[model samples]
Target chain A: MTDRLSSQFAFLDEIDRLKAIERATPIGDNSRPENSAEHSWHIAMYALVLADHAGPEVDISRVIKMLLLHDIVEIDAGDMPIHMAHDAEAHAAKEAAAAERLFGLLPADQAAEFRAIWTEFEAAESADAVFAKSLDRVQPLLQNLAVGGGSWIDYNVTMDQIDTRVGVKVNRGAPRIWQFVRARVAPFFSASR
Target chain B: MTDRLSSQFAFLDEIDRLKAIERATPIGDNSRPENSAEHSWHIAMYALVLADHAGPEVDISRVIKMLLLHDIVEIDAGDMPIHMAHDAEAHAAKEAAAAERLFGLLPADQAAEFRAIWTEFEAAESADAVFAKSLDRVQPLLQNLAVGGGSWIDYNVTMDQIDTRVGVKVNRGAPRIWQFVRARVAPFFSASR
Candidate 1:
């Protein structure tokens, strides 16, 4: 029991480094780029608070689980914002390797569970996964919208890109949030375009 | 729909300020003090991962909700470390007021739901609340223990104080974790005593 608990704690310790892994979006206050830890935290809260808007069969608890573990890979692979990534395949491969190494620190059963959650999130297939993905996309979009497209401006992100990447996921899982996104992001993207 | 969505977003924006509210304990790495946002996130993760160890009949989902919303009041009341505060009643009043104002930023339904969760955590009578409280206590204790009693040593915290304040809670909700805490923290307190 002690050894197993220590392994779990070791895994937790490794992921604490997520706090230092900065994401593309600035925090709402624009104090600095938000770290992955708080990003996961914020989206988990979003999942619970907005679960009603998700698809009918979506399990909110599962979505929250996926959100919490989704970014653990960034602890090793480092964050490559979807907007900035040049090659999706390469990024996914790197993240997969990182997930194996990081989650591997846990005891066997926990390692399998964590890796399965990460894999399920990456697949984004089920109702829960789709809703989890929506919350994930919605968080940075909210951050960008609140801060007047802080990262969007910095990275020169365009409307079509946002529509294609983020829009589809938000639309599929939580159509109401997609409506909000389209309406809210229109002005900034219009001016930029 | 737009109005309610905006209200929800407004609440989300308000809680983002939690990232700026720092706590006494450092991250596992000892890099710097952990902020309330990450602290909330870490503990929520802790609650999920350690749910099996909690007492029977505890509702894990409810406990997760409690953990996520627990420190949101800190966004307004600011973090008062358990070891430092001298007045419990004064702290509760400030936190209750803060919870009202902060959670109230959400739509009426969400505001009520959030307030209920926050209030439940404060009461700490339910099995879920007791379990949630255990994760809350264990997180900082682990952080402190990992960094060689980071906050405990700084605050000159003693074994008796920890026993009264944190040990009892951890013991009730998760006996295994309490055992780990006792074994791990014993050396530090022994040296100090």
Candidate 2:
């Protein structure tokens, strides 16, 4: 029992590092770049608040779990902003390895469960995973809009890029939410142009 | 449809303020105080990783939801440290109003659900709520221990204070976890003395 709790506490301690893994998206008011831990919290809240926007098939509880676990790999693999060009194969490999190492810190059964959820989220295969992925995309986009084109301005991101990269995934999971995003985002892109 | 989504987004933007509301406890590295939002995320993770320690009657999903929604009221009423002295009636009144205004930003149904979860968490009545409240207390204790008596030193906190204020609640919901906390924390206090 002691050993089991020790392993769990170690895992908890390690993931506290997630609080330091900074994302490109500046928080509301643009005080600083949001850390992965806080971003995870925000997107989990997004899943709760926007559950009505998800497809009927999405199980919100599972979606919330996926959102909470998704970016934890960022603690080890580092966050790759969607607009940034990177080696997809290499980053995927790094993320896979990170997931194994981080989740492996837990007891064996929990490690398997957590690693599987993280994999399911990465695959975006299930309804819950898709909705979770959509939220994962939506948060940064919302942050960008909130902070006067945050990160979009920094990365020189364009509408076409956002459409293909973020819109497609979000629309696949939640079309109504995609419509809402387009309505709010179109003006920003047009004004910037 | 747009109106519904707009209210949700507004709530999301408003709660982003939670990341700015600093807690008394510093994070693992002692670099800065942890904010309410990230602290929420960490405790939700604690619910996930420490679910086994909770009572059999506790539902982990509800506990996670409770943890996520628990501190949101702090955005409005401000965080009152457990060890600090404050007027209970005033704080509770302020927190109730905060819950109403903040969760009310969601669509009507979601607003009610989120507010209820927050209330349940505050009440700590059900098994799930009890476990959720335990994680909420457990997290700061863990953080303080990790940072070498982080907040305990600052607040001039003593062993008895922690036992009454944190341990009893954690033990009610998760005795094993409370045991783990006690074993680790004893060494810190002993050394400090």
Candidate 3:
């Protein structure tokens, strides 16, 4: 009974700590923030869809685990785009702050587990983490392209920038998916031209 | 590469299909619509913090998997609370509809694995599923008591009503946790009088 009651305390604490989605975009004319919850779901889909072309012998289950938890810290530190143009130091600070607040929600042992997964993802050194990162990058690229370069047009994004941001994602994670992106999505860049 | 990708898609599809968190609060509040993503994270904490009390040896790893994928269908069907006072048909219809849409998100085989985990949870037939469901029930009861009758106040819920709702939960899952709930939470009802 003591345990059951404590479980809820842990649950509620985590909920309170999840970061609010702050990315805003105009759908037609209205703008709204994309909360962390939505971002997590979208990334999971990218992981699911792109699982086939992952790096060799990848334990996708671990990749799924990492992807689900990696951004939870974003709830505390807040999200910054890869190109949000912050130096590594500030990036480290923001993610580090987020890591402490978010992981702190769990009991000591569980918090350690979650914190480890998040850290592993940040390093992007492991095969699983790298695969997960690829999906993270690819999902947003697909979203932007699907939205007809919605954010790209809004931000006046250039093709070179998009390539730099999402290109290596293909090189590292799944070469096939990257090729598809190039063939299917490259036309969009030229069409915009 | 293809096998890993397809496997993830299959699991994701199944997770999406399960109508895990369709349970809602008695009254309509946006909060009742707590996403599956939120519920999964909450339950993972339950699995982690309260693992010691579970009767069966809990594979924390497997428990985490179940918790993470449990209520995916809620993504499409939205959350439905347990005490909404709906007919059996209406309730079943709501969740069933949600299951179809949510699971459909994944490619194919991935959907089946997710669906099985969800089924295991709803059945309470498997050890892992039983522990997972126990945690699910435990988390919210604490929240309601912590917030001084949370949705209870909003919906004008009575002590008897909460007991009845929690009764089925207690009988089916963790006995120890159930006993604690009765002892600690019953006082809340008595003190209110």
Candidate 4:
């Protein structure tokens, strides 16, 4: 029991590093780039508050859990922006390894549960995972929109890139939210061009 | 429908301020004070990773939701530390008002749900809320322990104060966890004196 508790504590202590893992999107006021931990919190709150817009099959509690656990991999692999260019296979391999190492710090059962949730989120296949993935994309879009094309401008992200990279997944799970986001996002692209 | 989405977006935008609301506790390495948003996320992760230790009646999903919403009131009322001197009645009134205004920014149903969870967490009456409240106290205690008495030393906290303020509640919801924490925390207090 003592060993189990210690493993859990060590895992928690290690994850504190997620707060220092900076992402590309800034906060609403754009004072600084938001960190992964807070982005996870905001999206969990997004799951809670905007759950009504999710697909009928979605389980919100599970979606919230996935969102909270999703970016923890960023603690080890670091934040990779959606618009940034990277070797997809290498980044995925690194994230998978990071998930194992970090989640492996927990007692066996918890380590498996967290790793499964993190994996499910990466797969984005289940209804809950799909909704969770949508939210993962939704948050950064909202941040970018709030800051008048935040990372989009930073990376010279185009409308086609936004549609292919962001729109398809969010629309798959939460079409209404995607619709709302599309309307808000159009002005930014038009003004940029 | 558009109006509802706007309200929800407004609420999300407002909560970006929470990332700016600093707490008394520092991160593990003591680089800087932790913000309320990341703290909420960390504790939500704590509730997830440590649910086995909670009382049998505790539904961890509810506990996670409660933990996530609990400190959002701080976005308005601001963080008031456990050891800080303040009027209990006045602070409660302030927090109540803050909850109403902040949660009120959501669509009506979401506002009501978020407000209820926040209030339940404040009441600390239900099994889930009790566990949620316990983890809330536990995280800061761990942070303080990690930093060689992080805020406890800064505020000149004594062992008795820790027992009365932190131990009792954690023990109530999770006696085993409290026992673990007690053992880990003893050396810090003993060394300080």
Candidate 5:
């Protein structure tokens, strides 16, 4: 029992570093880039509030779990901005290694459970995984759109890039949110042209 | 449908303000005080990680919902430090009102669901609520302990006060954690004396 508790506490201690793992998305105010922990929380809140908009067949509980645990690997891999990370192959390799070391801090059963969940989310095949992916993409997009496209402007992220990279997955899971995003966010970048 | 989506989005916009509502407890590094959103996120992660330590009868999912929404009211009421919020009556009134206004931003069903979850957490009567309350108190306590008693030293918080305010609830829900806290945390303060 003591050994089990130690493993759990060790994992908890490791994730405290997540608050320092900054992401590309700014807060709604554009004061600073949101940390991965805050991003996970925000999108989990989104899962709760906006689950109704997801496919009717999706399980909201599983979606919430996936969102909560999806980014734990980022603590080890460091965050890669979607627009900035050039080599997709290297990114995948780094994250896979990170997942092994970070989740490995947990007791055996939990490490396996979390690893499985992370892999499932990465696959994005199941309905819950699809909706979870949608929430993940929509959150940064919302933050970007809310702050007049902070990352979008900074990274020179074009709408077509966002539509292709983020919107496509969002559309697959929650078409209504994608519709809302296109209607509201498209105009800001379009007007700049 | 648009109007419903509008209400949901409006609520999301309001909660973005929570990132600015700082709490008394610092992050594990003692660098800066954690914000309500981060606090909520951390504790929800705790629920997932520590649920096995909770009483066998407690429902982990319900506890997670409580921890997530319990502090959403803080976005409106402002965080009253556990050791500092003296006028409990006024604090309760303010938080109740805040709960109604903030959660009310959701569509009727979601609003009611959130309100009920928040109320249940406040009541702390059920097994799930008791366990949720334990996780809530433990996270900050762990934060303070991890950073060599950051808030405890800053606020001049006493062992008796912690035992009364936080330890009591923590004991009811997760005695093993409370045992861990007492053994580890008491030494830090005692050494200073």
Candidate 6:
């Protein structure tokens, strides 16, 4: 029954309480810490700018919608870094709960629409989601590279770990980009090895 | 000169910082926070949902673009609430400085485009800018209503103040909605007074 002007909602204050939850920042110029909002915007841009890269069958606007709403759950569950030593399963549980609470902020209709998008992003079953996920992963890697290797250095990250973290995604969205990453990093690691 | 991807750029931790910025919630649900990223998304929806109400001559997509990029500067100067006891002149100074630092994040072409949008929104001269501003103002009132008189009660906000905050925006964007707000709130306030 409620809408954008429900007048009885209690979460207004709590909504203000939410903070940007992002992974730890590293030192460097090429690197920039992306906020959840910024991350969403960037992903949306990917849908716009990289539409050609997405499978021709995918609906880019849907992918954009997915990216923009994907992280709303971090409002409650908090942000976790891709390179964290945390348990993946536990993080998933927290995010799921957060999604329910955060998206519940909207009126029933809007909430349902947003919830569906977030859920689709999580499912990653669709070609669009798959492609979006790749950009999500690849963007951070490039950011680290730009910043002269950020979290990668602090964690003593190796090429193998980077590949797993980023490779799987690129493979799904753009195998060519994945191949490019593989070709670039394997040599540096091989020489070190 | 430094550009979008800093070959030696500093602020590698910008991602987390931005996340923190985006997650920082405002006083209302419908109202866009001072964050540039969320502001973009919120405004897009406004353009769509209120398309019927928009001036016939306005480009909805252009309006959406203006909204999305309008607030990227809060990344540097931070958010200034509409009702906060702040100096309007000083805030303008702070924002100008922030715009330079924040929008400069994108590559040159993007930076120019974004800065122009931000400027246009601030100028409020264009139809898209006017409509975007209207949405910005209306969203908070809707949020306060939705959250059960949220910031309205918390701030002991007055009818005169609320009217002034949203009056022009509503009139400009959707005269009908403005009329609806006046019809709903005017009598209630007079009686309460």
Candidate 1 lDDT over residue span B44-157, tens digit each = 888877776877798888888889889999987889988896688888899999998999998898899889888888888888888898889888888888888898977888
Candidate 6 error regions (>4 Å):
A1-4, A7-18, A25-34, A175-193, B1-63, B72-129, B138-166, B174-193
lDDT of model number 2: 0.90
Worst 10 residues of 2 chain A by lDDT: A48-57
lDDT of 6 by residue, A34-84 (tens): 556555665565455445556787876677667766776777777777777
Would you list the C-alpha lDDT of every candidate in the order shown?
0.86, 0.90, 0.62, 0.91, 0.86, 0.62
How many angstroms is residue B171 displaced in model 5 relative to the true structure, after the best TM-score fit? 0.8
Q: Total clashing residue pairs per candidate? A: 0, 0, 25, 0, 0, 24
In angstroms, the error of model 2 at B141 is 1.1
Encode model 3's per-residue lDDT on B1-193: one tens digit a residue. 4545444444443443222333432111234434455456556655655666776566666776777766665655555566566576775577667665665555566566666777777677788887787787766666676556766666666668766776566656677777766776788788875
For residues B152-174, could you state the per-residue lDDT of candidate 6 as single tens digits?
66567778887777786668766
Clashing pairs in 4: none
Q: After superposition, which runs of candidate 1 have C-alpha atoms over 4 Å from their true positions?
A: none
Q: Under the 3 Å rule for N, CA and C atoms, how many clashes does model 5 have?
A: 0
Q: Ten consecutive residues with minimal summed lDDT in candidate 5 chain A?
A: A1-10
Predicted candidate 2 versus true structure: per-residue lDDT over A24-43, tens digit per residue: 99989799999999999999
* Better-scoring candidate (TM-score), 1 or 5: 5
User: Tens digit of lDDT per residue, candidate 2, span B68-126?
Assistant: 88889998999999988899999999999999999999889889999888888888888
Model 4, which residues run further than 4 Å from truth?
Answer: none
- Assess each model's interface with DockQ, reporting 2 decimals per model: 0.71, 0.83, 0.23, 0.84, 0.66, 0.17
Quote model 4's TM-score. 0.98
RMSD of 6: 6.6
TM-score of 5: 0.97
Q: Which candidate number would show the highest DockQ if scored against the true structure?
A: 4
- Candidate 4 per-residue lDDT over residues A104-160, each given as its tens digit: 999999889899998999998999999999888988988998988889888999989
The weakest ten consecutive residues by lDDT in model 1 chain A span: A7-16
